[model samples]
Target: MSTSPSRVFAARLSGLPVFDPAGDQVGKIRDIVVVLRPGGLPPRVLGLVVEVFGRRSIFLPMTRVTHVDSGQVITTGVVNMRRFEQRPTETLVFGQMLDRQVTVRGTGVVGSVYDVAMEPERSRDWVISRVALQEGSKRFGRKGQTHVVEWRDVEGFAAPDGVQGATHLLAALDEMRPADLANVIHDLPPKRRAEIAAALDDERLADVLEELPEEDQVEILGALDNERAADVLEEMSPDDAADLIAELPPETAEKLLQLMDPEEAEDVRRLMSYEEHTAGGMMTTEPVILPPDATVADALAHVRNVELSPSLAALVYVVRPPLEPPTGRLLGVAHIQRLLREPPSTMVGHVLDSDIEPLRATSSLEDCARHLATYNLVAAPVVDDDGRLVGAVTVDDLLDHLLPENWRDTPGRPANPVRIGGTNPGGSRG
Candidate 1:
């Protein structure tokens, strides 16, 4: 039987893999170029600029796309070096997607968005996405045969900063996993990552922190506010959080810790005491939690408002409110969709299944994986000896441990991962 249009498109694109019509491997796509009305409107793909030889870029029109699969983008032909375009004035590929936001449609309503990715080969040409949105990718918890929309399907581009058309894409962009983020960051030069770190807003920074490496977390933290830093740290894996804190100079760390809530700071301090890379060292103090009596509405509210981990609300731990001590006891797990469905007044305990599964702070990656496999869970709660929820580990977090160093090189990762430091290196204004 013939595949439906969507499947055909997805099949042709998902498994096809992207290649430069110009045949230049270095000129990997930075951003998928789209034609947009100067004013706000849906954008359409015009072409793609793949980084060819170092700093040299080649443009591939939408026609160049042969297929896109969950793993790669296949092109009709190799890009010729002669066809490569010169680098643009900007230093980063993401610079091309700046101030712009576009949508990708799934079966019906908008599915997600086309966020930024980096093209290091052509440093000047930052934008390059011949196709948008990959399905069956865990980066965003996407499943099924990955589908990709060509730039042609996109609406108009958002205007650059300060313009009315600048779309607010924080939610869509932040939905990716930390490993995905790390892949994006790895594609860019370390300096560029640090620079981008300094330029990102608090929300963006927090989003990035969940996915960055230990080295990057420190470098970026130095550029953010004590409060912002604290906020990001609060949501991070305890080990990851403590690692960033330990990176801070003694006085600086102490001062920032002082600015943080005593409870939060104390938790971090305890994690800090553990050796880095160990389970106790790497676990997080913060995880999704709901009072055993909390209603689905209440859990939903926390997911939307409280901001646990960036792009992670897969697992919500149901815990009893402390009577003896404020230990976050484990009760049940609530999926985001589940939490959104039931009435706001639905008590968590009543809705919650008693078959609760939990992980320990001292568990190894192998152990974590075993729990995930046993429960078929997207996220598993990490608890202390008393069964108090200290943090929760999402499938994404565990996946990060298994991925190769350069996740971007593999297909299904975010296309635009790098965030360049703009003209203003010291500020996070953009």
Candidate 2:
């Protein structure tokens, strides 16, 4: 452990890459595991919650760690592939400790815990030794005074339950993808999950909500006020928002729909009218769309939007007048690759691949899947009875509907779990 830093701040280790003794990258550190002692003593560092490939979180024992630095963590080359499950006796430093309100022992001053420091004790065991606190601020944009004190000097970690701020936790996870953030939130206690979900902004929450399990989505949305919930619903893709809303009580769903913006609400309502497994139900009303007369450059520009998903951005839906969903008529689609090769001034209609038949709104899930697979398309247009372009069904959307309802809860695992360095008799697999 000579190469390990003398002390490490938990906040700084949030997403640092974890590598093996052979220099193979394994996963990134998500959270630290610690066991609290009964007396007023520092909590013993147990291990780390490392999120491996497939978004499956696994435990990496401290004894297996060879070195740690600001940039990365080096392990003994052995990692348990079993999913990480929090034990009743253990606490997650980032998940359960950060943003916790505590009082100083001597002064009556109170503040929220932002970070904690861990160091190796005389026994060569890592322990939480320091706590960083930030007092509540008076100004809107300014943070209050911050203090770093010995762990023993802080109080309130033992409190049964109360509201916890998500500032620091959110900051530590700010760079995480929505799906990854959703995974982290999915593993938290119910109370903490709702708290963190509520703290997220409407757009961020919407993106995360779309990635979460249906039950978790319902629970988090249920925890929000009607107004805010409606706002969040509006932020989600129309199909996703409609699906989630359908899970709610009829009355609640109606209330939320009424509260949402008229235009957004209309899209959700139209989507909800279709059967769950139909093309109309699964398609996104906001795919990259362009009029037939539009130039290749215009189509490319629309697909270039950073916010659009890769599949949605891979093709431009060419239609007649009325650019919105249910547009006048479906001309065809122009693949991004094709658009890139064509002259910028060329009209998209001239290069359209209209040979492939479009899917009807009533097309079954199987039909939609077959259509995309046959044409080797990432997405296909969905049209109304009059052959007007209504929306586009993407491969991702199809897979989301085709997978088991609980597929999100069960992440894929490697056939053979990786193991290196002789097995440790003391290490817990999870």
In order of listing, the candidates' clash counts read 55, 0
Worst 10 residues of 2 by lDDT: 414-423
Please give the CA lDDT of all the candidate structures. Answer: 0.52, 0.90
Task: For candidate 2, write residues 1-430 as lDDT tens digits.
Answer: 8888899999999989888777777888999999988788999998998887677788898888889877899987777666788888888998999999999999988999999999998888899999999999999999899999999998999874978979899999999999989888887888889889878999999999999999999999999999999999999999899999999999999999999999999999999999999999899999988888899989888988989999999989988889898888898899999999999999998999999999999999999999999999999999998999999999999999999998865756643345633656325723
- Count of clashes in candidate 1: 55
**TM-score of each model, paired residue for residue:** 0.51, 0.95
- What is the Cα-based TM-score of model 1? 0.51
Residue 413, model 1, lDDT: 21
